[model samples]
Target: MRHVKDVTFHLLTHEDAVELLQFERAERAWFEQHIEARPECFYTLQGVAKHIIDCLALNAQRKMHPLIIRQRGVIVGRANLRNIADDHAWVGYRIAQGAGGRGVAQSALKHLLTEARCVYGVTQLEAVVAVDNAASQRVLAKGGFTAQKRLPGYSRVSGAPRDCWIFEYSPALSHGLAANNTLY
Candidate 1:
């Protein structure tokens, strides 16, 4: 685990299944208010283990960076660099309801930015946020992501069709160059 302030990011592992399941179940309803709900099966231990296994498989294939976030050794969130390619990946995360407004998500996003940019050599990072999720929007902005566009009916949030904004992070923005030429 690597630490940023009091938060730590650990690569997802089989041993995390039980704890992660508990975190997910405990925050399921709260999370659904800002993101889509997971299928009922995902709330169980075995189901979580299976989900972890599947993510690990993607991880092994070099297509994802799946990590669990913690603060003082308690599960606070989960984040990832998924759909990874040569120099781009989609970033996503879920923070426990209790951790809201405590800088946890911002720290987690900062760590993910470091991981994606340094460890994975990913220069282009993308995040999709439900338009109504102002907390996450602020986190992304503070982390240097720029609004790209609105994706109409992108997905369901709280079981209702909601538009989303595609936010993007590119090192070029900091370097003041448009060299990243990768099409959005």
Candidate 2:
């Protein structure tokens, strides 16, 4: 694990599976019963663990990557560079409930975007955020992503199809430079 500014983003390993499962358990237990959320967390631990395993496997190929976000040595969030495209990757993130409002997600995202451009050769990145998640939308906006469109029924939030705001970022558009090369 290496620190990104004040936060640490760690490359997950098979040995992290158990700890990740435990983190997911606690996170789910706390967030599942909330007012609004993503449906992916509605599954049983067995299913969730399977999902994490699949993520880990995909990351192993360098086509995708997931990182656990920690602040001050405490697990606080998770983010992923998912659905990689030619010269691009889709990004998503979630901050623990108690960790919200402190700019943790924003800081993590800023660092991740820099790493993506400088280290991963990602020329473009995109994110789809639920319309009502103002905090997340703010994070993406702060990271230089602009709203591309509003897709109707883009995701299942709390078992209902919710509208999503699509955001896209390019190094030229964000940092005024092109991607150099892939870090790996």
Candidate 3:
């Protein structure tokens, strides 16, 4: 587990299946608008159990870090550092509807950054945001992620292709280093 004060990030476990199912069920409509469509079973306990198992396996393989966000002892969201390779990982996050606008995602992400560097040995992080999700874009920017490019048809949402904005957070770049080893 990792945390920033009261907000905690916990690695996914089988015990979290029930809570995760409830969270996903509650946030289904809200989440579907911004993310790819989930399978019908994703909102059920069986699905969550399978998901936890898969996450644990991925963690053992050092290819993913799947976590849940907790504030005041209540699970509020989920985040992942996946596709780890070459000292980099892809980032993804989702906060419950009632949990938005409270800086929860940002704080959780700050903790995740530390874990990514120290625990996962990842030096770079990347996220893809739906073009219409301005709030998420702001959160990423506030976390020191810079927009890299616009990807056309980057993903499918509700079965339709959607464009997305790619953002990247580089620890070296944050320290003022240029790509060619020059200091800014």
The 0-to-1 C-alpha lDDT of every candidate, in the order given, reads: 0.84, 0.71, 0.83
TM-score of each: 0.90, 0.79, 0.89
Candidate number achieving the greatest TM-score relative to the actual structure: 1
Query: What tens-digit string does per-residue lDDT give for candidate 1 at 1-184?
Result: 1234577889999999999998998998898888878998999999999999999999999899999999889999999999999999999999898887888887777777778877788978899998988989987877778889999989887667999999988876545422332121
What's the CA error at residue 31 for candidate 2, in Å? 4.7
Error of 2 at 134 (Å): 0.8
> Pairing residues by index, what is the TM-score of model 3?
0.89
Q: Model 1, residue 131: displacement in angstroms?
A: 0.8
Model 2 poorest 10 in a row by lDDT: 175-184
Alpha-carbon runs more than 4 Å astray in model 1: 1-5, 175-184
Q: Rank the candidates by lDDT, best first.
A: 1, 3, 2
Q: Model 3: how large is the Cα RMSD against the reference?
A: 4.6
List clash counts for every candidate, in order.
0, 0, 0
Q: How many backbone clashes does candidate 2 have?
A: 0
